[model samples]
Target: MQSSLPPPSRGRGRATRERSTVPRSVSAHQEAVRSLLQAPLSAAGPAAELPLARARGLVLARDVTAPVSLPPFANSQMDGFAVRSADLAAGRPLPVAEPVPAGADPGPLRPGWAAPVMTGAKMPAGADAVVPVERADPPRFPDASAAAEVLLPQTAPGTYVREPGSDIAAGARALPAGTVLGPAQLGLLAALGLTTAPVRDAPAPRVLLVATGDEVVAPGTALPEGKIFDANGTILHAALAEAGVEVVDGGLVPDDPGVLRQLIREYAPSVDLVLTTGGVSMGAYEVVRQAMADQPVDFLSVAMQPGGPQGIGTVDGTAFLGFPGNPVSALVSFEMFLRPALSELRGLPQPRPVVRARLAERTDSPPNKHQVRRGVYAEGTVRLVGGPGSHLVSALAASNALVHIPEGRGAVEAGEDVTAWLL
Candidate 1:
């Protein structure tokens, strides 16, 4: 039976321990997780004035108006002679003015004379066109102070001249609030003479990560007869890092609840959230559930395959999230829940790109649960990688997309369209 939960949360909200064992819907659990994190995230805050180098991936806090137009003044786009287009009509040599190197204020052009302009040099006022040096007589700039003359070809006005505000006008919006800073956006700011931008570089929650279960052994060590390498810690750590969260590796904790409690009690003060992988399923040695029995966080059975079992709540004032022992389930949990919360709170433009694609193979899913299947998304189609099992790490590795099979969808046809999230 489904639990009759409230729209927001139930009870003192603090005392919202599991009142029923019935599974919650995937979206319901996602909202629960987000509601739990909203406060600390707000406490962590936003709105920082960061330099251009550090503002990438952050959202603009306010509209950035251009201080000066792009290419504030007219400039040459080539190493050529800046001349009055009318003066060059005769194709005759004219007295060469001072050489205008980049960054120099050469001066206004005198009628009937040409100014030797290097690339990006300010075009002398009154000069309307540029004739590439190769097209001029002798094809070389005359020595400064040498009383030289040069020839130029007739060219239309504005040739090779980058006019002011051609890219963006002065006092116009360069970027609007909520625009994520990227290379192109940052470059535009630099061109606008801005050294820094006011951005919403909200604090990335500091997570204390622990890998649980006696069956988990650190990588590079002996894999005993019954033990496997710990892929969860590495996977979760890498994912959290990519999302910009500061991760503190808490290493492995055995199935013993005392050790788990001690580790959390000690590190709870230093971290904004506590994350653990394994021991959340319905097994005899479910250490995470055993340890969090008294905490206000709820141990939920979400209506989702693979990652159905979840533990989310607070432990000693530190937010907590628990994922199943299976590698695939753990990652799916991160993708479906934690990643979205972090991205929303951090103000990222898009946490992940979701697309609709045609399925390349037939599949079956439970009608009551949402299913996430690993697939290879290409050319608007998604092909399943392996059997829909939670332990298929090899198949997960070979996949680049997560095909989302929504609740109530079952027995999907080969050519049916499905929603996919690009990794």
Candidate 2:
């Protein structure tokens, strides 16, 4: 049975034509995405206290202050003899006192003696310098029981001593807000004996994903005649998960406008975003396009290949983005537009790293549209992975980078520099 669709509103098709007549530049579309997100999502949320292990890759919501000075107390930076600099002035052999092993607390140094100290061991009171073991007259740590007098070269005070607060002062800021908690940042917190971190309250944006196509079926199920297994859902699910988005699968919707509209209306209230694959282009069975024909959504054809058809609108006040059905096109649209916009809105780091690299082979690109080609980038060189085809899912998997051939440039010669985004 066919479902009735709303009549197209005035200026809807004209808007699409006007947008398609002049292909939207990559930067322009990205700007539009950014403009749609006026403020960060965390602004409306509360900060969360997460354990250090769970805080990795999250932005800090507040400054982390050191509870105590780094190194806590004065300690030896090397395995040597902790002695008064005055004792080494005359080049006289000072009798070694008790040895200070790591985690051990020894008494103050004697008037004319030295104390053997291990690396990271606390320096005894009255000790002004540490003579490295190799610099001692015996060039070794003496036996604890034996009467060992080790001559030491004259050393300056504070030499080889890791003074308290050298790395970080107590109550001082160890990390500032908005800092992404990477390994070094987490290590700093760990060194300060912190078990948890106050991270930005950027909760994962819940998304409702709808794959619309009568010929598309879920994987692992028996394929009906003239039907293809759905890849857009799988691709988008994994991508959204990697981007830290909570996805509520809306399953597959057929080419029925009423069913699609009902699904959007059902999930829009609980989701921050709605994403659909297919039914956004200028086709007869474009159910999503027809359902939103009277709505605020604008469906247009972008100038780029593999992902030219695009739709961005709001369904029931929830942001909606419609991508092409091809696996590679859907994935590319997310990376090129949605991901960066979401990152800005959610305080997440930009997922794709863009870098310039020399092309390894000559390649041609269509004029007047930015061609994004999958490639293998290695050691400052980028080679095309496969032919330019939106259905080449395997090729996209084999590639590690996306090479951008700019508009107005038809062909790029080998060894020429081009911009690439690292996956």
Candidate 3:
């Protein structure tokens, strides 16, 4: 006969009480972080005056009104002569009084004669139509005495003349506030005689990235047994830069609680957001969790492989996040959470591209977990290039997309339909 062992102690609950805190479930923690990160921003000050050349990708802060009508005045659209329809009714040669070569004032036009005008040339006063040089029968010459006078064979009123204000009216709202400035917008501003554009001031957020691990070595250093090189810092730095973030790489902080605490105390107050990798699990030496023990942090174990662990909180109003240590896990976590949060703060749309593709091979995913498998999408089919191991770098390189397999799903047979989010 065997004796029954005493009931196990509820150490987890006791530990929570001892620390006066509890680890929030994955969903609850994710929701809390999402809410804080996507909070509405307060209204900013008036628009900034930026040079038109430097205003690309910025939102206009105020409405721009045209100062004057487009074309400024009635102009000739063809290179020919400007004359009244009555002058051509006689079907006789008309003398050219003056020349209007685009930007040159031809002075007032006499009622019974024609003025030689070039395309874009301002029509002389009292002129009502423009006869193209090609349409005139024997085009006229500069000197009336030495010229073969042309007959206006076609006499149509208001023909070949661009009326003033036809394209845009004076004092009209050219572009409303919040208009995203692009090449077309810049061209419109230039056409409206505006040398400067009113654009929203870019909000630059300073970010601090801290990559933590004991087994992680710098990229240039030699790797020992069970040790790997760090890539998250470089990858995340580039990603943040592309997203318009100003990042200062805080470098690696090993899984040492005292050092981690010191770094956080020093850098947390200086940055708008603090990002880290590794040390948020229930391991005995989880430095990130240990360091923030005195501070506010919500630990979460999400229902996702390779990126299941996360921590989010604030240290004196500065936002902080801890992601898993695996390279793919870190990137995937960022794509799902941080990127969207930052885009929301910057008033820009999220960058996830979704499309449907047929699976090229059989695949299976665990129940109640969203499996984001990397694969290559081609010819309307997605080929799984690598195993679902997060540490597989070659697999990551071979894939260009993440196939989102929903929870509680089983094997996906070949040629089965699935949705993929392009990276």
Identify the candidate with maximal TM-score. 1
Overall lDDT per candidate, in order of appearance: 0.86, 0.84, 0.75
In the range 111-199, model 1's lDDT, one tens digit per residue, is 99999999999999999999999988889888796999887777999999999999899999999987888999999999898999998
Instruction: TM-score winner between 2 and 3, please give it.
Output: 2
Ranking by TM-score: 1, 2, 3
Against the hidden true structure, what lDDT does model 2 obtain? Answer: 0.84
- The true-versus-predicted C-alpha distance at residue 323 of model 2, in Å, is 0.9
Question: Ten-residue segment with the worst summed lDDT in candidate 3?
Answer: 1-10
lDDT per residue (tens digit) for residues 1-423 in model 3: 001111222212111211223333333434444565543222334578989988887778889999989978999999998999888887888876767889887788997788889899999989999998877766544554464456776578889999999989999999987677789989999998999998778665678888998988899988899988998888788778876678978898888988887887788777778888888777878888888787667666766665877877765567778888888888878776677566655655445667889999898887667677898998889988777777887787778887877656767889998888777
Instruction: Tell how far residue 328 is off in model 1, in angstroms.
Output: 2.1
User: lDDT per residue, candidate 2, 1-423, as tens digits?
Assistant: 001111212222323412355666666666655654443243536689999999997888878889999989999999999999988888789998999999998888988899999999999999989989999898999888788889889999999999999999999999987788999999999999999999876667888999999989999999999999999999999999888789999999999999999999998988888899998887779888887876677777777877998887677777778898889999999988788777766665566777889999999999978799999999999999998899998999999998888777899999999888889
Q: Model 3 segments beyond 4 Å from truth?
A: 1-30, 38-46, 62-188, 358-360, 377-382, 413-417
Best by lDDT: 1
Q: How far in Å is the alpha carbon of 349 misplaced in model 1?
A: 2.3
Candidate 1 clash pair list: 297-313
lDDT measured at residue 112 in model 3 versus the true structure, 0 to 100: 77
Which ranges in model 1 have alpha carbons more than 4 Å from their true place?
A: 1-22, 44-60, 86-97, 111-114, 133-156, 179-188, 199-203, 360-362, 378-383, 411-416
